[model samples]
Target chain A: MIIEIVSWAAVGLILVTSTVMLIIHDWRINLGALALQYVAAFWLVTRHLPFVMGSTKLITGWMVVAALGMTRLSLSSEEDDTEPSSLLRGGWFRIILMCIVALVTAGVTTRIEAIIPGLGLPVIAGGILLIGAGVVHLGVTSEILRVIIGLLTLLTGFEILYAAVESSTLVAGLLSVISLGLGLAGSYLLLAGTSPPELENEL
Target chain B: MSAPILWIAIPFISGFIILSFLRERISPLIAGSVALILALTALIIPIDTALLLGSVSIKISPSIQFFGRSFTLTTADGTILALIYGLSAIWFFGTEASGTANRFVSLGLMIVALLTASIAVEPFLFAALLLEMAAMLVIPLLVPPYQKPGRGVVRFLIYQTLAMPFILFSGWMLAGVEASPGDINTTIQAGTMLGLGFAFLLGVFPLYNWIPMLTEESPPYVVGFLLWAFPTFTVIFGLGFLDRYTWLRTSPQLSGAIQIAGLFMVASGGIFAALQKHVGRMMGYAAIAETGLLMLAMGLQSSEMLNVTFLLIIPRGLELCVWALALSIIKPKVTSLKFNDVQGIARSYPFAVTAIILAHLSMTGFPLLAGFPPRLALWQEIAGQSLSISFWIFLGMLGLILAATRTLAVFVMANENKIWQRNESWTQLIMLGLGVIGLFTLGLFPQILQQFLVNLPALFNHLGQ
Candidate 1:
């Protein structure tokens, strides 16, 4: 009973962290929150998937963060002149908006449990929240890096739910590969957007 | 060796090899020749039956087991493979002329291989994974070395990725529906999910906003190839679903839903094409319209549905290649493909101008062009069923016609002082000329392709049989 309660706490943390990551625009904070989100996801999924397989998800989530970070470092100019990463331009207004969306999504997902019955309620609710949040993130932002983050968040949510339902090794591996590929592609696009236009051909 | 391994592995391996070694020089010719050879081999090699050419017997088995799944290639697959590889050869060969030979051929070959794998993979839900991988692979091609990815590319990726979960989940639901045929709720859920999944994959109507964006941002030829390849295979994949489920096939409500969806795409695509300022965007709209036609063909309950669908595929492929090649050749001379930028370019590159006009006319179903026959058949089928739907579809065709006419007027409106000149190289002239001729030949003698088209339905055991 105690273990189950802790697991539910982890699930709740996943929703909180994912919402926070979406609400916060700072790359560092976003990355940190992503890592935490994965840990919580790993915790939830560990009940269903074997430990090794579950660890693959967490390891891959970090690897993606690492890939994106390295790309940002390599591509960011030394003479950069922008405010350091923080809450985006609209600030708390956006946060409030996100909170409303989260609340609405939570309500909708809670109701959805009636239709798709066999799946556990917490897993479905958390997964749907992540999916809904990721989509909302994509809808709001046009930045390549942010969109990638949104896509990854959405995919992570899907993996959490999908892992509960189907435990095929091949699928788990393939999904991990897809995650890695998306990160690498995201990094490439980020750098491409940053590169000098005249020197584009050389790249 | 099994046919699946032979077809799938060889092209993929060759693609990687070309990317690594031969891309800098002679890439187009090598890639083109390899595709042509592969297509020819697929054409000649009888799948599932031994062939006798001077006492030697040769038979290729259809299925190969890999990673505990099946990849099967049947005799019915031969004609389809031939069509895919043959059209690919056209794209590959034209890459040199279009000046996008470097990465286009290498990645193009790989994309083709992966799409073919999607068709062959058994327990076919795995196709969703392969398709996701293919969508990822397409990113580098869409966004070149230092070029930022466009809205189209990102949206395209998002939409394609979005399709995976819908399809995978539907497959799971479909298994339940198949197990319990009497369950109406499961059936409705499966059908809705399946429709949405395919709508995303095929870029139906509202979900197709990226097609025009992609055409504007990416190289016309590469975008054209994607427009052709992704939808053709997706349509087939959808048919496979219909083939598998009798409940789905017999559902009148489901069929009506498909028809309405198809009509919406046609009407929207055609009307949008008419209003587009950019030629590349026009091609995108044309693609959406053609996809709509294919959807309409699929929605038809007539016995000739598969034949009509396959018929549209060939001509549509040819039209896109012709249009894209012409655009690529014309692009270097202009900053953009807008009417003002390219007004009266016919004076400079008459052959390309002619090819573009012909291709667009064909797409609009002008007489004695490749897009005529299947369109006529589709119209007949729809007209018999519902005159109102047919009339709206006709309005869509009228929109395409208007766009083509406007394009021609713009092309021909050059200054009288500028001398008429053949700016295209002999190679481009030859390719454009041949494409034009092929369109006419196929249009005039469509019977030449009837044998292949008629036999395509045989691949699906009980589908529309």
Candidate 2:
């Protein structure tokens, strides 16, 4: 019973952190918090699997891909550093985010339990965390490219919640395809906006 | 099933050929001709047998499933295909590219094909995919050279992508309920799914601004096609989901919700259009209003509603074609798409001005034109529900007419009255003649459309119940 409670609480913690991070538009801290949230979610899902090697592989594969994706994202941020971070002064936004997250997390937790039998508390708690992390990145970020990457993470979290009900294979597969499409489109939009050398005079 | 696939496939294959091999000289002509042929075929498709393909077989009807999802493709999809075929044809003819129009054509065909796929494919997942593809494909068209895609396209795409998870999760959730241990909770979950999916796909409240912004950036003809046809297809898909999946119509709340949405659309669209300075944007608003009207009609579900909606199609097509021609002629003259740009164009070309007036009036569902009968039927249907709704429709109609009057005023203002030097060629004469004939023919014989309109309702009854 306590194990279930803790699992649920972990989800609650992640969600609260994420919502707080997002509304405040605090990407740096939110990034750390979001990564940790996913880690906790990964632990929750895998801690008691029928433990199929394939499910294990799928979960691990997603984690590795996600890690690599974030790494590349961070590396790419080298250029963005040239522009000051938009959220450096947004402390009040963070506090307000915390209040909203706490209220929503509490509401969603009970609702999930009521909606889906046996798995409500965990599913609700986890869905909040995943969605919360993504929303932060989306709401706060000004860099168009970064926001796209943030969207992918947010969707990934939702996939986890959806996975609680259905198998991860179907949910994850469709999501990956959608993310790649989004990322490609975002990259195209971003590159299109880059200042060309010919425009040196124009600027 | 194959026939529905063909509705999407033929244009797709033609688009591929044009984009790849025929890029040099005649691709645009060839592409336009093919669209014309497809449109004609769709028009000629015998309403007696709604589905063009011989058998109206159903492979998936939301009852059966594989891998945690449902499927629903069948004969009832004919009207949607017809809608797509007509819209694409108009767009194809309406475009003229000096260098390469094939990419845009390819994208258009792909979008149409995906829309048909979304209609015919069951499980709603296919619909979401098509929606994604449709949104992504617009990137090429929306992000042109001069306007480097300001926040509008970004906002539009993000809103579109955001709708995806709601739809997918809803499908997943509904399936979960279906698989539950003999529970009544399934119904509520399914309802939530429908509400969320419909809201997401239709761009229901906050997310709908994309339509106008899209108009702000896109080629007018192409945007017009998207404005007119794509939402109609999505609405049809949404309506089909309601018809095939559950007892959505019987639920007064569900139908009432749709009516409420329709009311919001009609009301907001009118007020929003009034604020716009661009003619293209105005069309966007008008399309939104038309969408609301279609939704209102759908909500009524008279055994006659389907026919009424189908009847609504012909007038819409005619309105779009006339608008497309008028705009296509005007595109080169104006530097910007603002009303101030073409404020008095009506005085310059009397015939073009007349066509514009009639088309705008018809679009507003004005009297004595092709657009009136359906609006009349729609108002009559709404009146049976409640007088307040009837009053709303009446006011909406008046607002639409006033909007048309504004357009007329703008066109007249744009009219220079200084004889412009464009040649009056045989083809121009033919097009003008076609436009005039299309507008007045139905006005003279309303029965011509009423016959087609009568058979369209009752195409799909609630199958699952």
Candidate 3:
């Protein structure tokens, strides 16, 4: 009974963190939220997988976040030091807009249980929120880095739900590989605008 | 020896090797030769048949197991693999001409291998993961050095990633549907999920806006390779779904949905292409229209669906290569790809202009070109189903033809006072000429392809029974 309560609590935290991640413009805080979101997802996935195995998702997700963070650090300029007011340049209006999106996502998840039943409430709700937030992120921004985050968030949601449906070692490993690859590719794309030091030296 | 090992792993390993040690002056030549040799080996090496060469016997197995998954490349796949690698060789060889040879050849080869593995993997739900991986690999290739990633590339990644969960979820639901075949609600839910999944995968209708944007931002050749490789394999993957599900194959509503979706893509792509100011964006619409044509063929749900689809496939690769190569040649001379930017280019680049026009005409299904015969067959099939659909499809083709004519006018606008010149290298001229001849030869005698396509439908033994 306590485990159930704890799991649901973790899920609730995940939902809040993912929503915040989607709502915020600060890269560091967003990455922090993303890492917490993955850790919370790890709690839910542990129901399906062994602790060590389920923990793989958290480890790999953090690794990805770290890779993204390093990329941001290397690529950040002086102007980026200022805290942006809102996620979108439009400010509070976009925040309210995303809040409405959150409400709609909650509504959609509540209804989705009718079609795809038998999953735990926390898993379903959390997964849907992650997916919904990810979509909103993608739809909201065209920035390559943010778009990559959105994709990663979306995949994390899918992975969490997929663990409940099927558990294959190969798939788990493949998904991990995909997450890592996304990180590297995202970093590459994020930095593609700048010439490498070697290239500059050669020139 | 295993066929999957030869077709999948060898190319992938070779790709890595080239990227590691051989990405030099001769990389394109090496990559092209390797792909060509692999294509030939795939063509000649029969699955499960022993070849006796001077008292030595060798046989390639049909299937291989790796890391608990099975990859089977049956004899039927020989031709498909041959076609894939052969077409891929065309792209790799042209890499030098396009001047993105280093990474394009390596990444292109790896992408092909992964896509092929996606098709071959048993318990095919795994293909979604492989496809997502391939899509990720495309990013570095598409985003050039010292340039920011464009909206098209980001959207492409998001949309492609978006497809995975739907497909994976559908696979889960489909298993339930299979277990309880009598459950109507379950069947409907599964079908909806599957439809949505494939819609995202195939970039159906409104979801396809990124296609043109990517074409506009990236080198036309790379975009062309992506257009050819991704959709062709994805269609094959969709066919696998249809083959496995009797209810899915036999459902009239599903077939109707496909036709409606297909018509929407064709009609919209055509109308938009007709109004497009940029030639690169026009190719994007053309791709969407071709996808619609494939969906139309599949909607026929007839035994000949595979045959018609394969026919479309072969020529599409050739035509896209020609068009992209032309665009890449013309690209260096333009500041932008808008029709206005390309005015009077024919005076400087006549061969490229000719290739671009010929390729566009072929794509528009002009007579005596490679895209015509299959398109004719497709029109007949759709007409048999609904004359309205046939009319809309024809309108779409007509729009493309108009766009092609407009582009041709722009290309030829500069040459009234000056004599025309062929600025293309010998390699470009030879390849373009060969592509043009291949297009006409295939159009005039499509029978040469019939034998290869005849047995493809049999791959789905459970479908159309």
Candidate 4:
């Protein structure tokens, strides 16, 4: 009973964290969410999982590496560093605006899910649609910097789907790995600008 | 005491030690010798399974039957090890190529170690992680100065890393067939997983960028290794996964989905390669095209595709040598990869010019050289699949032939002037000769690698089934 409660609490924390992480658009905050999510996941995976332990460790190790990749996030956030990027100059507004729109849509769906019988599908669809929008924003843009933002948004959708269909050490394990990979990528996308200042730190 | 175990351990230990001590001068050279020894070990080791260090005995062939499933290594594993080591042999030789080769040798050894480890281990997910890390190492190597700062490397790393979770997720999904053993999927979960596994391997849709960035910035030889070796392992590993999950292989729809994804790669890779000029970048497109071919072969869902895989390796191997030899001479440096740079230089280096043409022609699949036969065979296979698709295959082939022609034109128009040449060296001629020799040898005896190719899938089927 005690173990069951711990696992449930862990799952709840992860869901809330995932939702909160998606709503916010800052790299630093997302990094924190990523770190917390992995730690919680490691806790989650260690709870007497029935399958192979080697498999569990290997998958989780990938997650930790990704979460640890937040170090790059810190390095890239510094100014006049490398790759003078056009996207980094002040392009946060449009993305922030999009997030706001996604949030409003998400709010309406949550309320609908309370009353309607089949509203769950629409809720999931809304979430996936918002992610597709994020992909489009990043895909068409020439500035690689924004793609990281796009990756973060897409991952948020994947995590939600990942969480929805299954809630166990395995899914948690996978989400953590995917999240870390996305984090590191988001870190690099920030590095894509070719401004002269960015080149020095790269080598 | 197994050769599989030892072949796995030595280079792995050497690779890590070499990387940790990368700043040391002799480390890489020593690492290369260690890798060479390991490759040799893979050759000599007879296939067998036993616990050396607290190993678990996984019985299937002769029946450890628990819900009617079997998994065991047949004697055929020896050939796979041989193939792994064969590629590693040349890569180990690459250790002697430059200062970078030392570290490259370490990474290459690690790659070998991972491949060796994956094959030995039971759960396919472990192999997937091993492959992912191997892909990740390509990042530091792919860093080119002119391309957008560290972003490309980071993006490559990020995208590859991102693939991990889904693979792990799928690993968990498929873990049932192996662990407790049951019908496994909760309906379409099997199909969804099969899709994710394919996505991870093919790097489908928006998730594919590392290939282009790495090819563009990487040293030609290194690009050559990745172009051929990594995909080969990935396909093998992916097949191992699909083979384990009965739903994927048994269902034609699942197989068709994979084929569609691969076909997309072939079409896009062809279009992309034709539009590019840099030799390394061009190699990337060709590789993408090859990935699609691998998929198409897999899509054929026949052991014959595996035969094509065997034949595939020879031309690709020759092509790598050809590309590496050609690129080392062409432009000679990043400052001048443009066609104009090599122009009039043929007047300065006649032997180099001829070798470049031969190399390019072979790489582009011209007749009577290395690339011709496999391409012809590939056409036959695609035609066998569907004559309508042959148009797409031919169009793709045309794109490759056209790319080759463009590259050759770049050389010819550079104004061949052997009489005005300054000088030539014996070693350059020798390496060039070896590449020429390899191309011709494979071309003349399209059956040179036939024996080995025929043996491989049978082996994989034996182990996997």
Worst 10 residues of 4 chain B by lDDT: B59-68
The C-alpha local distance difference test score for the whole of candidate 1 amounts to 0.84
Report model 3's TM-score to 2 decimal places: 0.95
Following a full C-alpha superposition, what root-mean-square deviation does model 1 have from the true structure? Answer: 2.3
Native contacts retained, all candidates in order: 0.48, 0.18, 0.70, 0.10
Candidate 3 ranges beyond 4 A from true positions:
A79-83, A87-118, A196-203
lDDT by residue (B333-374, candidate 2, tens digit) is 677768778776765555655766687777677778888888
Cα lDDT tens digits for candidate 4, A1-203: 67656645654454444444444445446446645544444444344333353245435444544543544444544542333453344345545645555566566655635533332433343345335544554544433334544555455545443444344443344344544544454444444343363553433
- Candidate 4 per-residue C-alpha lDDT over B370-411 given as tens digits, one digit per residue, 9 for 90 to 100: 777877777787787778666765566567667766766765
Off by over 4 Å in 1: A77-89, A93-118, A196-203, B51-58
lDDT of 1 by residue, B112-184 (tens): 9999999898877768877888888888888866677889998998888888878888888888898889898
Error of 1 at B114 (Å): 0.8
List TM-scores for all candidates, in order. Answer: 0.95, 0.78, 0.95, 0.73
Name the candidate that leads on DockQ.
Answer: 3
* Residue-wise C-alpha lDDT for candidate 3, range B73-126, written one tens digit per residue: 888788888889999998888877765648888888999999999988888888
Q: In terms of TM-score, which candidate is strongest? A: 3
